[model samples]
Target chain A: MNQGWTERQRPPRLERRLEFADYETTRDFLDRAALVSERLGIYPDMSFGRTYVNITLHAQDDATEVGEPSRHFAREIDILLETEKTLDE
Target chain B: MNQGWTERQRPPRLERRLEFADYETTRDFLDRAALVSERLGIYPDMSFGRTYVNITLHAQDDATEVGEPSRHFAREIDILLETEKTLDE
Candidate 1:
């Protein structure tokens, strides 16, 4: 539903891919994202390489649908990324 | 190619799913795996929930096939897991 996220059908998940200039930046982003996830009490499924990170939030559950918490978590991540960008500048 | 890992066809990747007793153990395993990946100079695609971590090592590339580095990397991860298991005991 967001600009960078794709909704997948097979597993019913919202996915996003992020690319960074280097591995350090990518790792830093992941560390921050982990902290955010811990605070939010929700963890997105995550995959990463040297300069790329992919995150997925499942959309379907018995109690929740369409990844409501996941979307909120993504927004929080976006804020963290923005704050990191501002600091880098 | 080894126990606990499955070879997938769609994207041609080797995948392993690990389950932990708790989120803390899962995160600890992930942190150690990240370190091993960094030392090996190869990163696996990783996805995590509260108590499960799924990791995939791509098997196909122009220069590599069937995930040679990935299998080696997985072995390193297995070693790390063994070490952690020993520590836990």
Candidate 2:
């Protein structure tokens, strides 16, 4: 859904990086991402610092192709990023 | 001081890998780390998945040594992990 995502192959996954102005905003996004993971049962690997988060949604199997679940989860994360951005304004 | 920590060279830093039995425990550790960071004004870079977190405390400057502040922060984090472990029992 969000064109900002980058598709990566080899093992297959989608990744996106988002930057925030400060620690508070980054915390908010991480907390929201956790909630979404709970609701959808999709837990992406996330690496974050004070001002940024790198999220990776790996393919569900070893078929060398990404699937619906990861794409769906990425879309939800994209939505959360948008919501976080709006709050920053 | 907990001997479980690993010290790195080059840029110089202290690092430790913590494992949790579940996501809830992992979240608790992350939350407590944030609180400690705010109180002590030290923020370590962390990368975490569902069950583990890698914490790295960089040297305060370019002197190529992990100083007192980073050591103090690591001890506090060690304490937090101990407390979390007690709660788990």
Candidate 3:
């Protein structure tokens, strides 16, 4: 994460951000995220501003206790971003 | 979509829903969708209710006009759902 931008070159804002609370949760997570972006006037596959950025999310959670009470745990989010202009438009 | 359940077996409610405005936009779409789920107390990777359902989204937008003004168009949404009890709990 935050590997591309140099310390001085990175902007204060994130082009796109994806966070999740568990693993293999991308399917459900993405659904809700897209809904939010649409409400915010940002529709996926639709260009926004002058730049095209893609962000991804991957999440995982695990809590296993045989005899004791089960404790929930999750940490799985994968984000991928790309900069490009719309080819069709 | 909705191919698994027989007509009689299908429920009136959707286990999960994923809708998008374009194609190959999973990265950004998923990010925003997940955010919305979290706010809805349905954080990704976290079990909810008695069933585990996974929903996916795939969107595509295309507008090609050589001499005319471009008109935005998009229609890409894939949804998947699964019913299973939690193993850990």
Instruction: Name the best candidate (by TM-score).
Output: 2
Better of 1 and 2 by lDDT: 2
lDDT per residue (tens digit) for residues A1-89 in model 1: 44887877766777889999987788889888888888888877787777898888887565334566788998888788789889999
Q: Score residue B83 of candidate 3 by CA lDDT.
A: 15
- Per-residue CA lDDT of model 2 for B1-89, tens digit only, reads 79889989987888898888888788888888988888887778888878888888888777678888878889999899888778768
DockQ of each: 0.61, 0.74, 0.03
- In terms of lDDT, the poorest run of 10 residues in model 1 chain A is A59-68
**DockQ ranking from best candidate downward:** 2, 1, 3
After superposition, candidate 1 runs with Cα above 4 Å error: A6-13, B8-12
Range of the 10 consecutive residues with the lowest summed lDDT in candidate 3 chain A? A67-76
The per-model lDDT (C-alpha) reads: 0.80, 0.84, 0.27
Q: Global CA lDDT of candidate 3, please?
A: 0.27
Each candidate: fraction of true contacts kept? Answer: 0.68, 0.68, 0.00
Candidates in order, TM-scores: namely: 0.81, 0.92, 0.20
lDDT of 2 by residue, A1-89 (tens): 88879999887888888888888778878888888888887777888877888888888777677788878888888888777668768
Docking class of 1: medium
* Candidate 2 vs candidate 3, TM-score winner: 2
Model 2 ranges off by over 4 Å: none
Pairs of residues clashing in candidate 2: none
